[model samples]
Target: MSSMKKRMIKGMVRWSVLPADCILNSCIINIYKEGDYIPPHIDHHDFVRPFCIFMSKGNIIFGKEIYFVGLSEFRGSVTIPLPVGSVLILKGNGADLAKHYIPRVPWHKVLVTLRRMDHSKIPYGFQSDLELEELRLYEL
Candidate 1:
């Protein structure tokens, strides 16, 4: 599918859950090629909550590509083998507070991929219009 079409789909997901006062801020859907991986890093954005949904899976090694380096760091790194239909719910602090990356494993290095299903596509009456913009400003 085209990137824009994909983006629109992602946007629909985002808008569906957005609060009435929030704006349909930022939505991203990423695809990682085989042998490709995202480096360990933290999100440098201002968002109340940041959530991710695994749309598809292609040999993934979760939690192996992260190193906590702050007060909120977890005791140890987590290596979860995420399967299709799995949902990863993360708060802004949880996602941004710690550093994470795709680990380099001997077996394929695990291609990590997921889509952001934001909350901004609900019909009227689901939430207040004012809250929509407020909610969208932060990570969904």
Candidate 2:
């Protein structure tokens, strides 16, 4: 697909080594300011197995393998403080089992995410189910 190829090229331009024909669903850009955070949760399975997540602006404290139990939660063994312009690719059960989240930041930050899709995994004739696609119609 042209869109998938375009997304792959975009990632390559950002210095990614992924194949140029990698089937990517789309690119998501998030801009978070002070006091903003990404709530702890596992990435959805709509996309493919590997998720390419990166940051382009400021630094962030990245938590991995988070375990939650009702009103309480526990941090796993890995706690990485990511630097600017860092790219992380997660595959297999990395996302399926472990949860990752970015805590509230004291400064502004920007994140670019590339999500791939397995055409076979996607439900057929469900394009209308995509809110983003509907929004794209108005160029919103």
Candidate 3:
């Protein structure tokens, strides 16, 4: 609908696995300081399409399993070392069936997240100039 939306959608279609018709109505930028952690949970929002997490700095360990005693035990859970400029896309089986979280970051971290929103969930007064052309320069 908006110029930014059009650009992002076009970029995703060309550069990512996002469907050609996928429509992302919103984007989120998150910053996490050292010692920060997000509890594991399912992102079952209907408006949200497959989410993408792009790391700008620091390292993180994703996917912590929940223990019976009401705690996170990342014993054998896969640990992904996200160096700066790493992008992790969440989709398909892993996105729908499992919960994932980032444990405390050893250093500051920044995340650029894009979420495709259904019409009803689009945030009001949101606008951006997403440079679709830049997608061509990015190494997928």
Candidate 4:
């Protein structure tokens, strides 16, 4: 495994944001330029609860019902400023009921999202990573 990933997993487990046994087999990298915004929506159920690690400064808005003001803008119950390298773990009502979105970012931003795919939802022809399969925070 990459040293960076190792460090991140360690930090997450140490902070109790993620349990030691959580196996993250899927990853998505999102890069947003200035003026870019993401619409509010819940993550597909194909994967388990996902967590996002911010690579740049930005704000994420979350609410049970997200209202759009216009393209690139929105209104939500709360707006939270996420610092660089901050990790946001989504679960329960926050992950399944509430929708989340990013307002137009003032500058470039990058986010790394990690999740464990549901066993039955994994696409055919996909090969599992043995290393990641056995990875645990306690073993790091």
Whole-model lDDT for model 1 versus the true structure? 0.43
Candidate 4: C-alpha RMSD to true structure equals: 2.5
Candidate 4 residue-wise lDDT, 1-140, digit = tens? 46566567666765667875666667778998888888998988887775545557788899999887876678999998988867788888889999999788888888888877898888889876665555455444
What tens digits encode model 3's per-residue C-alpha lDDT throughout 72-107? 334325666776767676777557766666666667
Query: Which portions of model 3 show Cα errors greater than 4 Å?
Result: 1-11, 57-65, 68-76, 123-140
Clash number for each model:
32, 0, 0, 0
Local distance difference test, per candidate?
0.43, 0.60, 0.60, 0.77
Q: Candidate 2: TM-score?
A: 0.63
| Rank order (by TM-score, best first) | 4, 3, 2, 1
Clashing pairs in 3: none
TM-score of each: 0.44, 0.63, 0.66, 0.85
What overall lDDT, based on C-alpha atoms, would model 4 receive against the true structure?
0.77
lDDT of 3 at 131: 50
Query: Which one wins on lDDT?
Result: 4
Q: Where does candidate 1 stray beyond 4 Å?
A: 1-24, 58-76, 104-140
* Candidate 2 per-residue C-alpha lDDT over 1-140 given as tens digits, one digit per residue, 9 for 90 to 100: 25544544454534445543453566688898877777677777777756777875443333454555434234554666676767777676666776777666678888878776666676666452232232211112
Q: State the number of backbone clashes in model 1.
A: 32
Candidate 1 residue-wise lDDT, 1-140, digit = tens: 34543453345346564233333344455555544555656654443344443434433223434545543333225555556545554445556565554433333322222223244544455532332333332255
Output the lDDT of residue 43, model 2. 78
For model 4, the stretches where C-alpha displacement exceeds 4 angstroms are 1-3, 137-140
Tell me how far candidate 1 lies from the true structure as C-alpha RMSD in angstroms. Answer: 10.2
